[model samples]
Target: MMLPGFPEAAPLAGLAGGLLIGLAAALMLLGAGRVTGVSGIVGRAFGINDSGMSWSSAWTFVIGLPLGAFLVATLKGGFEPEFVPLPLLAVAGVLVGFGARLGSGCTSGHGVCGVSRLSQRSLVATATFMIAGIATVAVMGAL
Candidate 1:
């Protein structure tokens, strides 16, 4: 099967984004001594569990997710991503949520923080994640 190719991958933008993410995650770890895991932060914000960070702080981090995106969109003259069908999007979201639960954290948590700490589990989990995403794209394209 011939899969749709994304020849427009923006390497510079991707590198900049990755560096920013690493810087943010590193600052969170060094300054706060907490992993900047979105799921963990958001869960704490909602009082799911008591973590080292304060509830307000956790919520602040959660809010930054969208605010940062908006800031980037504004600077980039608006962000336009390829739109997936709504139904497919919903299903993908559900699957992501389930995967997060099963994995104990979101990709940002394990992929960024955990891997940086040289965690064996995070390395395995990140590998599984990439594999799953590639497989999903392949299967969906085949359909």
Candidate 2:
């Protein structure tokens, strides 16, 4: 689906975004021997014991995300998303994040890196997430 307010450059923009993401993931794995798993990174942020360098890099990446977006907007220009509501967004974020942790990976981990590695568990988890997302949208549409 076309995102509201994104220019005709959206597809190219998306390609660039995907390329950057893949490059970052590949670089992380090659350089630090770490999987770019958002849930795992967040878990490490919450005091999970792992390699100090990996945890620190994960933390840096997490912190850099918003900053990078801001820089991109400054360079490329874009619309900022309007929130449904702060409280609702916060609650949903917490629930989704917890679910990601419980599922042992986030969308990026399962959808990108894991699938690329041909991991069966990642395939199943990614499928489950996609199905759940579709169902949620359908139910919301009905409501």
Candidate 3:
């Protein structure tokens, strides 16, 4: 449903998505005894790191992310999303990868799992992520 002040906001859809994400994260942790960390899983899938998880399993999870999105978009008759140029996307991806490595875990891992467990590092990392995101938006808007 649309939000009052935000014409394009779909609160129900967002809530449903959030619930699904939480359920998936919880299932991943309980069923596999692993945090749903995309970056680490991607690394493992690519043989960049050994995390005791099977390569095929990691790859399946990584692939499912976009596949799920595609399914949803298709079911909804698709949407036109404006994306930056390939070069900018490549640069952004590299920077995000570097940041995830430096931070020891990505948002899903630290923010969702670790924070749920009340880990200090995850709390700090999540705060840092939020702050950086806000600052980036402010700066970009000002430009």
- lDDT scores in order: 0.86, 0.82, 0.90
* Candidate 1 lowest-lDDT run of ten: 1-10
Off by over 4 Å in 2: 1-6, 48-55, 78-84, 141-143
> In model 3, which range of ten residues has the least summed lDDT?
1-10
Error of 3 at 76 (Å): 0.7
| lDDT leader | 3
Residue lDDT tens for model 3, 1-143: 55467746477778889899899999998899998888899999999887678999999999999999999999988979888999999999999899999999899888888899999999999999999999999999799
* Shift in Å, residue 138, candidate 2: 3.2
Clashes of each: 0, 0, 0
Q: Least lDDT summed over 10 consecutive residues: which range in candidate 2?
A: 46-55
lDDT of 1: 0.86
Tell me the tens digit of each residue's lDDT in model 2 across 33-105: 8778877776677666453455566688778988899888878667576769889989998998888868887
Clashing residue pairs, backbone N/CA/C < 3 A, model 1: none
TM-score of each: 0.82, 0.82, 0.90
Residue 101: error of model 1 in Å?
2.2
The better-scoring model by lDDT among 1 and 3 is: 3
